[model samples]
Each structure stands twice: as structure tokens, then as C-alpha cells.
Target: MRRREGENREATNLNVNSLETLVTHIQVLSGNIADLTYLSNVLKQSGDWLQSEQTRLAPLLGELNPSMHSLGYLYILEAHISAPISKEQANELLLSVARFINACTAEQIHLAPEKFISVCRRFKDQVLLLDEPLRGVAPMLTALRKLQTSCEQLTALHPEFLLLCLLSKSYKTGLSILEDDIFDFDQPHDLFLYCYYGGMICIGHKRFRKALELLHNVVTAPRLIINIAAEAYKKYILVSLIHLGQFSTSFPPYTSGAARKYLKNFSQPYLALVESYDTGKISELETCVQTNKDKFESDKNLGLVKQVVSSMYKRNIQRLTRTYLTLSLQDIANRAKLNTAKEAEMHVLQMIQEGQIYATINQKDGMVRFLEDPEQYKTSEMINCIDSSIQRMMMLSKKLTTMDEMMSYDPSYIREAEKARSIFDFDDVDSLPLKPDIDAHLKDVSSSYDIDD
Candidate 1:
């Protein structure tokens, strides 16, 4: 008992009386304290003690292999950031923490979640403060990937990581995270930010369909104010115009009343652009864009608005395909409102190259021959794609069945259902309709109808 108490006391004594002794002291602690839970609890409980020793403790954390002493390093790092530090020192710690984060053992880090969260939030700030925030992208992503228990579990880090990716123009890295279906999350705000930033990432990828879907989620998701959703709604309008070539004036029935009322007022310019785009007149679209040029530029959506114009051109050209089997480039130029035959030919060649239209352009004759789609869906790749889609649908069906079963087994749902059934159930004496000589009446009716009695 005395020996064990001695060991416990020694573990608690985090004194670095001298710079020379700091490394030796940490080594002793790591070696003597065999139980990680004990070490984790000690570090957690003594955060104040650790904070006082921050000057001595900070250096030791960098010296220790984070994988070997994750709990101690996490707690110390959390303590180190709890107080303020100079910008110069923060830059230094940013590099240090990034290194630690990459090397930290995942299993041990989970032991002190509170400390881990603190360090992560601080790290995000440190990286964002750099002159070139893009430098933070790779490390932030690595940290997020490491810290999360599962890809499905959304954390506070999710929004910051996405912001870094956006700042760095790392859309593919952002999509790698966004592609995961988040089924578990503790904060509503985190979910909102995830959808918002994730939608922007998809837009960067020119994935208009996916971008619209994600932005729509932000708009319709239940909220009291929905400022983020309102911002997402503006982007939603632009994407909807580009992708669907039309926009609905009304919000869906499920959208919060606050969104429907205020969103339109805030984004009136974008809404007007929608109106002009619906005209299918390139001149009107261009005019609306020029009129709202300042607002779109301020919102950093000037580029996206330009894509809407190009999409309109493509849409106009595609319409011509339905009408004429073959048309000279000059006729296409006239009908599509393009300036010249060369411009029309450029559009045709690009569309054909993208497989957006099945057409052959005769360069010598300055004519385009639109043809029927050639895909017969007989290739092995097509078969595999179709089979995969069916499998996914089957999986979704099974998931829905499982969720329904789980809901049926919920205590609250079961209780409410029982209450409803009991309240609606009728008693024989009180509620049953009185039928005097019902059997005789039935027999008489049957005889009257010439049925066998």
C-alpha cells in the first residue's frame, strides 16, 4: 500500500524545477505510470497544475512521441492553449501541434475527448491565422480524419476543415469528406455549416446537381432563424437556374416560415436573375447580370452567374437539335442568337466532345448534323452500373425496413400508439350499434333477393 501510494504521488508531481530535468521527468512519468486510464485521469484532473507548468510542459510534449504518450500530450496541449500566447508563439505551436496531430495514436487520444476537442479547435485557429491559409489544408484534413471516431460522426472540426479546403481550392479533398452520409452528430450548427460548405465544394467541382441538393438541404432543414440556410438559399437559386434552367418562386411546404419570408427579400437580385434566365433570352440574362454585377461579385458568385449564361447558350443550342436534323452553322448562329457561324460551330464541337449532344460537324460545309443518341445500354460497364444502382436501391429498402422496425420498438412510440388505440377503441355496450333481430333481417333480405336461406 505504501509503495503504490508512492508511485501515485510521484505520477502527480509534474514539477519541472529545471529545464534540464523536464525530459527526464516526462520519461519517468511515462515509464512509471503503466495504466493509461490513470495517466489520463491524472492529466485531466490536474489541468490547472499543467497550465502552471505550461512553459516547462510545452517543450516536453514536442519531445515525446505523441503516439506513445497521447493522453499526456493532449492534456498538456489543451492547457497550453487555455491561456493566451503571442502570434509568434502561436505560429510556432501551429507547426508543433500539426506534427503531434499527425503522429498521435488514435486509440489513446479517445481517452480524453474534452482535451482533444480543445486542441483541435485551437489548431484550426492557428492555421487560419497564417498568411497563406492554404498551407493549413492538408494538415487540418489529416487532423479531422484522425480525430473522428467514424466518418458518419460530425464534429466541430468539420466546418473548419471544409473552410480550409475551400481556401486552398482543394475541392476533391472536401468531397472526400462530404461524400460520407453523416448519420451521427451532436450539434445542429455543425450540420448546417457542413451542408453549406459542402454545397460550395460541389459547385467548385461543377457538380450542379449535387450542389443544388446539398444547398436545398440547408434551406429546408428546420431552424428558428436560418441565416446559414438563407445564405445557402441564394446559392441554391443560382445553381437551380444553371442546372434546371428554371426556379420555383415558392419554397417547399416543409421550409421554415422565416426562410420563405426573409430569403426572397434578401436575395431579390438573384431572384430577378432567375426571372430573366427563364425568358431564355441571352440578352436579358446578360443585362440582369450586368445590373446585379456588383452584388454577385461581392458574394463571389460572379463566376457562377457566368456559367448560367453559358448553360443558357448550351440549352438554346440543344433546343435546335430537337427541331432540325441538320442545320448550317450560320442558321444555328441566327437561331441560337450567337454572333457568328464560327461561334455556333465552337458550341457544337464542344457539346459533341462532351457527349452532351450526338452530332457530326462538317467543317468543310459549315453544317452540323444532329443524330439520335447512340447508347444501347448493352456494354458490360452499363450492365455493371445498372446492377450497382439496383443493389443500392435494395440496400436503401432494407435500411428503411430496419429503421421502421427500430421505430416500432421505441418505448415512446409504443406508448403513444397504445394510448391512441385505447382512446379510439369502442366498447360493445356503449358504442356498438344496436341491431334488433339482425340474423332474421339478414335471412328475410336474402329470401327477398331469391338467395338460399
Candidate 2:
């Protein structure tokens, strides 16, 4: 029994030694993976061999402790592989990659911005291709934001990288950059692309008005790029339908006539849909959608078109409030082309709840009453407008005050102002004769005359 116990102890030691060896191997592999310069050199030497090397190293990373630096490098290497990788193979790795990026120090990102940005761009493309809801988008965006904060030069070099990162639910980051005019792009396409992404981000956050403004910028760029303008025009039409219940005829006056003509041709389906909606005829709109179903689907605009269709009843119902103080549910149903009085009542109720209409419902009488008391209807809105104006003024005042303080304390500005004042005084001296020292000048003249005598 003692002999057997000794043998078991020897087996345990052997296992311990094996574990240590495995850990050593993991450390070596992780270090090698984290070396971006080394990986870049490998790719430069032989791109084909990089893939197999990455494949071999990837499984070993799984065996070791998960780390941000190692995961980030691995993701970059994987993206460099020439062959298309399956989403299933990439999904788990991508989650780790996102976490690693999010946790990276500003210094680390600054040290290796090219590698960091490459990972971000590749991850964005992969997520888009997967056609899945972005799961770790926020963290990835945070990582990109950190990189931008640390090294603005990266953004100047690859504005699209930061722009794509902002497209992934990073509206606050995107908006801050836009408001500050932080990006400097050498190419016009970059500016258009920035506006395009900014508009989409606004749409995601339900800031429809802001979205329209950004899209308008893209559509009306001075040197209009047709593809960007066409795309922007599509969004502009949909957002207009949602915001105004019809298409807008007023486009930017500065837009070229030729560009306007091309947009009209490109946006025919949307124009038809808008016209159908404007007629206040649900059947016409439905028929129009059905007829252009193939076109809408081909343009990938069916979803937006359907939203416009759904809003048709609301517009029709709203019209009735303007004409009638009170209307029976059945009348509303008939007028709005809804199937039943019950459906009409529900639509009205929803509109009322949303403050779209100043109206109340009478369940017993099955009637809807429009609130016609101007005071009651308009007072709250007036107050809200006043409050909003005050808030805006206060914000403006604060900004101006801050500017004044900055200017007042600027040493260089003060020095320049003093220099300008001295120059102005000298100019005044030059313009007007100065009074001479009279006594000294008279003595000098008398002495000169006495010497001559």
C-alpha cells in the first residue's frame, strides 16, 4: 500500500510538470500574436502563409487565458487572411475582439493605431455582411472613440473608419464630432460619406428632423456625386413622408438643374408613393404599392413604403378633426377607409394619446370630439415654445460668456492689440507735427548766429 501511494505521488508530479509546460507554450503564443509589427512583416513576406499561421495560432489562444491585446492582434491577423471566413467561425472571435478594443488603453491605441483601425474596419464589414443585429457594437465604438481621442491623425488618414464606427450606434460620438467639425478630409467623398452616416445614425435615434438636414447636405453637395445624391434622395423622400405626410417640393436651390433632373428620374417610385398618399385615398396608395412592389423590393425600400401606407389612416382621420367638431365612429370609419368603427376608434385613440390631434373620445356615444377651445389647445404648446426659447438663449449666453473669457485672457491676443495701438499712435505722430522744445531750439539758433558774427 505504501509503495502504491508513492507511485500515485509520482503521477501527480508528472501531471503538474505537463501543466507548467502547457502554460509556458500559451504565454509564448500569446506574446507572438500580440506583436503587430511581426505579423505585418509576415504578411509582407508571404501573404498566403499568414493564414495558415493564424489558423494554427488561433486554437492555441483558445487554450490559454483570454486577453484583450492577444485577441485584438488575432482579429487583425484573421482579417488579413485572403479567404472569406464564415460568420459562425468569426462571431465568437469578434466578441472577444470588441472587448479587447474597448479595454485597450489610449496609449496602446496610439502606439498601434494602424492595427487598431484595421481591426475596426474589418469588424464593421464583417458585422454588416453577417446581416445580423450588431451585438457588441457599443464596445467596438468605444474602442474606436478611444483611438480617435488618442491619435486624431488616424481619423484624418481614415475618416471612413471612424465614420463606420459611428454608424454602429455611436450617435453621441458622431454628433459631437459633427458639432465640433473635428474631422478634416482631403476628399469630397469623405465629407459626403460622413454626412450620409450621420444621417443614418440620426434616423436610428429617431431624430428625423436632424436626419433630414444631414441627408439634404449629401443630396445638395456642390459637386454632386450621383451615387451619393441618389442614395441621399431615397432617404430624404422616406423621411419627408414620415415627417410631413407628403413629399417636399422645396429642394436646395443651389442644387444643379442636371442633378435635380437625375434625382427625379431616380426617385420615381417614391414620388408615386407620395402622390398616392397625398390624395388621401388609401386604396390608391395600396394599389400604387402593389403595382410598384417589385420596384420597392428591388430598391430595398419596401419597409419605408409600408410605413407610409400605415400612416395613411392617421392622416385621413386627422383631416376629419379639422372639418368636424364631433364625428360618429362609423362616419370616421367610412371617411378614413377603415374596415370597422372599432378600428377607427382605436386609431383615433392612439393619435390622441400621441398628441397628434386635439380630440377626445366618447365611448357611449361612439363619437370623437375635437377640442376647439383655442386657449386650452394652444396654451401648453405656447409655454413649451417659450421655455425652449429661453433655454436656447441661456445656452447661447453661456457660450458667449465663455468665448469672452477666453479672448480676454489670451496673452497673444493682448500682445497683438498692444502692438497695434502703438503702431496707431506712431501713425498719429507722423500725421500731425509735434511741438519742438522751444527754449533749446532758440538757444541753438542764437549760438549759431553769434558764432557767425
Which one is best on lDDT? 1
- Tens digits of per-residue lDDT, candidate 1, 143-188, equal 7777789876887678777776666667888898887767677776
RMSD of each: 17.7, 23.9
Q: Which sections of candidate 1 miss by over 4 Å? A: 1-34, 400-453
lDDT of 2 by residue, 1-453 (tens): 978955753453344323234334334433543443433333233434435455454544445443434433443344443346787866765675676665555543454566666666566556655643245455554654676653222252233433443434455555554543333344555566667666766655557788888888877775565655676688788778876787776566777555666777888887888888888888999999999988776665566677677678888888887899999999999999999999998889888886778888889999889986345536888889989889977977887788789979999979977996787531111111121222232222222211100
For model 2, the superposed segments whose C-alpha errors exceed 4 Å read 1-96, 126-133, 150-191, 197-207, 223-225, 256-258, 372-453
As a TM-score, model 1 comes out at: 0.82
What C-alpha lDDT values do all the predictions have?
A: 0.73, 0.61
Displacement of the residue 165 alpha carbon in candidate 2, Å: 9.9
- TM-scores of all predicted structures: 0.82, 0.59
